[model samples]
Target: MREIIVLSGKGGAGKTSVTAAFAALARDTVLCDLDVDAPDMHILLEPTGTRREPFVSGHLASIRAEACDGCGECAARCRFGAVTRTPDGRYAIVPGHCEGCKTCVVLCPRQAIDFTPRTCGWSAVSDTRFGPLVHARLDPGAENSGRLVALLRGKAKALAKARGLDMILCDGAPGIACPVVSSISGATLAVLVTEPTPSGSHDLTRVAKLCDHFRLPTAVIINKADLNPDEARRIEDFCADTGRPVLGRLPYSPDVVRAMTARLTLPEYGGPLAEAAAELWQAVVTLAAASRPQLQPL
Candidate 1:
């Protein structure tokens, strides 16, 4: 399957909306929302989750008071300084501060430390009007986003393969962080969605650098391209200079907001915005087909 990740170096660049539009156009594809921290694809796709499972990663350490001798060895050995004296004259492990290094468990004279599974979040498989949707939800203030992203991508790919699908449309998280790195890994193509603003241009360059580092084929889609024609020219020039293709440029339209209020894809909204989004989807399909392996069946 061809995995296409739509990403941006910053949030609110219309990346997810573009991904949803592409998903609406694909013939045989699975939609995956890899934005575990703030997944909104489900809102547009209206997916009904059929399966949900707890995702546990790493471990949280707790002290067994009954076994504690209060020798203060665990406190001294803990590098994270998670162990602290309690009002009852005992050392306690703070869940938020503990790094779960297991050093306290091993060095404690009384062997009072116990490691427990930490619930990071939940992953789900859902059925949407567009297609099979694989998405995840992260626990508030949870860590392990990179690992969760990998897991979500793997599930999406596996579902696509099982159903004999040809494409995996992923709405990747924003920024060049760990989650973004996981999103780009094994991607057949990376579509950088940007706007025509100074901040947009800056972040677009950052995302482009990340794609270059991974040697992934990349294309740029400029949303609100008319907002700043001068900046648009600069974006086009930058792409030309760097040998990256400008897939499509979409104009600023309030219809997109209306579509969002209706909880529908841009193409399904049926207006000037829908027409513009259709043109963008055509470009995307052309690129995806071009990037497909020659030996692979279309």
Candidate 2:
């Protein structure tokens, strides 16, 4: 199956908006929101009949107070300062402070610690008007966001295969962090959405380098290209140097905000911005089809 991931080096670059527009235009596709930490595609898609399950990963150490000898060995050995003495002089593991490193669990003289899997978040399979969407939510301050992203992608792939779908459109997280790395690994194409600003130009280079490191074919879309012609030209020059195609240049339009406020995809709203999005999607599909051997899982 062909998988196309939409990403941005920083947030508010219109990444999700573009992804939602692609969802409205693409056919025989499974939609995936890989921004586990902060997913907003559902706001536009308004999914229903979601099948959700707890996402369990990593481990948390809990002290069995009844089995403790009050030696305070675990407390002294924990580097994260997760262990503390209770009011009655008993040692306890602070749930929020614990790093789950298992150092306390291993050093407990009384063998009072119990290490159990942690429920970090939830994953779901839901039905949208366009197709099936596989998305997830990572608990605030939770670790292993990269793992959750991989798990959601696996579910999306399985669902697509079962339904005989040929494409998977993923809305990836911003930045070149672990979650973004997980989102693009083993994908068919990576489409980067960026704006015309100094930070946008800088971050676009960073994310483009990341895709290059993985040998993933990438294309660029300059959102609000008219806002700063010089910076937009700089971004285009960078893309030219890196051999990445500039798919489309979208002008700044308040209609985009109006469409989003109405909770509708650009194509569904129907305007100049929507027309540009449709042309961009066409370029993306053409490039994705011609792109060579997909990046193998890393």
Instruction: Please state every model's RMSD to the true fold in angstroms.
Output: 3.7, 2.6
lDDT of 1 by residue, 1-298 (tens): 6888999889999999899988887778988899999999988998875699899998888999878878899889888889999887888998888877889888877778898999889999999888999999998878999999999988998998899998999999999999999889778888899999999999999988888877777889999999999999999999887878898788998988999999999888887877777887777777876853222111
lDDT of each: 0.87, 0.93
TM-score of each: 0.93, 0.96
lDDT of 1 at 2: 81
Best by TM-score: 2
Cα lDDT tens digits for candidate 2, 2-80: 9999998999999999999999999999999999999999999999999999999989999888998788899888888
Q: What is the lDDT of residue 123 in candidate 2?
A: 99
Worst 10 residues of 1 by lDDT: 289-298
Clashes by residue pair, model 1: none
